[model samples]
Target chain A: MPKVLMKGNEAIGEAAIRAGCLNYFAYPITPQSEVAEYLVRRMPEVGGVFLQGESEVAVGYMLFGAAGAGARVFTTSSSPGISLMSEAISYIAGAQCPAVFVNIVRGGPGLGGILPSQGDYFQATKGIGHGDCRMLVMAPASVQEAVEMVMKAFPLAEKYRNPVMVLGDGLIGQMMEPVEFPDHLKSEPTNKDAWSTNGMDHRNSKKRNIVKSLFLDPALLNDNNLQLKAKYDQMRSDEVMFEAYNTDSEYKGLVVSFGTMSRVCRTAIDLMKADGIEIAMIRPKTLFPFPEKAVADASKKPTCTHIISVEMNMGQMVEDVDLSVKGHLPVSWYGKCGGEIPTPEEIIDVVKSRIA
Target chain B: MQSEVMFAGFGGQGILVMGKILAHAAMEEKYEVAWVPSYGPEMRGGTAYCTVVIADHPIGSPIIKNPKHLVAMNGPSLEKFAPTVKKGGVIFINRSLISFGANRDDVDELAVKIMEIAKDLGSVKAANIVALSAFVARSGIVSMEALKHCIKEEFSNKPKLIPLNMEAVVAGEKAGKK
Candidate 1:
């Protein structure tokens, strides 16, 4: 496909249609409302279902219902809206249903601001829902990457029978860039007949497929949790995706960042390279599978001294970095919680002062 | 290899659209581009601005503090962003609305009466197109042919507005040469 200038949110909406995900349910919120706005207009043209739920909570259950029936379904919401959808997300995960959620994150524990932020890092990767639920979280630094990740998410969700999240900041949702939606990435729902609650007649006379998260007996609940844990373990084993930048040769500092913040760090790395300062960076494309081994291996560089986690939030991802570094290198966190993104100069200064 | 332009004006003045047109033109020239807008609540009824980053390489940080050029549609926009333009870069001032100078001697400042030019051309709504053409023509960031194609494509839906906008581009490019 030819490249077109598109906002990240609108590109995401178009990407789902290209990916053959015909079910979309969403609630309007700042920064991300454009995703719903775009899909509401485009879905009908493609003979797809576009329903704007009353709230994010309703949207979450709507995704669960559509996805349970083996339909490719997704929704888009911001931080606070995601919070309302958390319960249903947990239920969807518990039932092992396939769904996609795009969180174009805004600021705060409450409705702190409508600008971009990575404060929802923990919310997306760790606490998307209650219980032993985990979503395969993908963080995209650019609009093009968001389109690719959104297209890749449906197949990944079906592969694990789990929810997959394309986590982006408000900037990723609001900014416009040239993006090409590859024709090859179109995907159809696969292998859903065995477990989906699609009508038995549709599946060629199979036993009833009950899609529910509730396991009344304690042993069954434990078994279900163990089954979910196994899927997550498999994700860690086979689904880890990451990108390493400027890691060749020896470097004094290693920076671990994801999402929009990674692009800023990338610029800082380029500026520092020009100044005869060597710094390597690892940007996690999949925040869930987390790319722990890549961070661990990159930290083991002989010339590396310390690591810094630069994010838009206070210190959420730093804890994970510290764990990934395994205390071999001291991991420090620097960030701004407000809507203001950390500048490239700020990142360079922090790495120079803190790494040494 | 990389340059940024800031388009600043009040909310209904097509500030974002101006940046988008520049970005589209740059993209047509096979350069990577990103268009970032000030999406704060202030866009409701306050100063609206957008930054267009055009680079030969993939853009890293979309947020730009100091842009390479400026298209100030009003006095407040010029007062706010004119100082942020890099030295030796083109700064397009819509002199029809902004009365003051850019106060910088280091840059090539092109002051055009964009509003009056557009008004005389048939509609003041084409003022953004006038300013965009002036900025593109003076800065040489993208070729005039590429920009004209983008302008034609932008108004492909309403073919009626294409001729007036094409005239505005001609006038702005003429003004930019001065």
Candidate 2:
């Protein structure tokens, strides 16, 4: 297949469609509005449903309702918008509904700024909402990876019957890159009839599956939480994905980053390597299922003395890096927030300061 | 090999489109490319800029600190980005708007009267195309033929502007050759 030049947001929208997701509900937000804009014309052309809800809050429930009804549905939003949807996301996760949410993250403590940021790292991988629920989060670094991750998201959501989040920063959302949507990644969604409220007649059974997060009995609620925990454990063992750059060789320090920030680290690693300062990188492709072992192993390298987390925000992912290193190595952080991206030279300086 | 180019000008000057076209042309030529725009409130009337990175291998960072080339369409853009161009790199300045030029002695500088050339071609808005043509012609980062094809495709919806854009490209190319 020939590659086509596409923006990351539009590529994700197209990838969702190719992945056989026919329903999309979203509210317009900068750095990610392009996804809704692209899908508006595209969904109808494919005999799908596209809707711009009254607000991000409304769209979250709409996606929940759609996904609960056994339709492959998705939505895209930025930081503040994602915050609005966290309630619904929690509901969907608790109910064990399959949905895909793409958070083209921007700087935010609260409406911080609409630039590339990883500030949502803790929110995404740790607590998106008030629950014991965990989401399958995939962080893609490039437009092509964004496309692949979106395509993979649908099946992954259905596989675990859990909501999957494709997390990227504004750079990945806005930048244009060459991409080819591989045919192999396109697949029919798995059967949701057993658990979905697809109408009694659609399932050819009189029994109706009720989708709700409310468990009145304490025992039943505890059982549900235990089951969710088991599923999460299964995911941790099965779905941890990451990319290693120059990890095969011995290094003085290890850099951990994801999404667009990882690309900056790659350039820094290259520059430092040229200057005879060896550094390796581990870019976690999946933010949740956090690639803990991969990071731990890399940090355990005999020559590796420091683990640095480079992000677009102040020290979010560094906590995870700290956990992965487990005090065997010191974890440091370098970041620029409120829409400022750290330059490769700046990152190199940080690495040097830490390891020196 | 990689070539990183930064295009900067006033918001309405089509600086982003120039970067987009170059990025599209590079993609057409089977190169890995990334185009990142400086997007925000400043984009309303403030100086706008975008970076286009074209590489034989995958691009590491889309946010380039020191670009290999620069297309500065106005005085502020030139004043701001000229020094950031790497040594031995090129700076293509739109002399029609800027009185000052790049002070760098190490890098090659081409100051083309792009707006004046586009005005002669009867389309002032085509000035970006003019500057883009000169940059491509001088740097050879992308073939002129590929750029022409990209321009046609980009303006395919507004077919009426195609001829004027092509004329602007030719005029700029001639100016660049001189």
Tell me, by TM-score, which candidate is best.
1
TM-score, chain B, each candidate: 0.97, 0.97
**TM-score for each of the candidates:** 0.98, 0.97
Off by over 4 Å in 1: A184-188
* Overall lDDT per candidate, in order of appearance: 0.91, 0.90
For residues A202-249, write the lDDT of model 1, one tens digit per residue: 775457788999999999999999999999999999999999999995
- Taking all chains together, the TM-score of candidate 2 against the true structure is 0.97
Candidate 2 per-residue lDDT over residues A251-344, each given as its tens digit: 9999999999999899889989899889999999999999999999998899999999998888888988898888988898989988899999
What would the DockQ be for model 2? Answer: 0.82
Model 2 Cα interface RMS deviation (Å) = 0.8
Winning candidate number (DockQ)? 1
Clashing pairs in 1: none
TM-score of chain A of 2: 0.97
Q: Which CAPRI level is candidate 1?
A: high
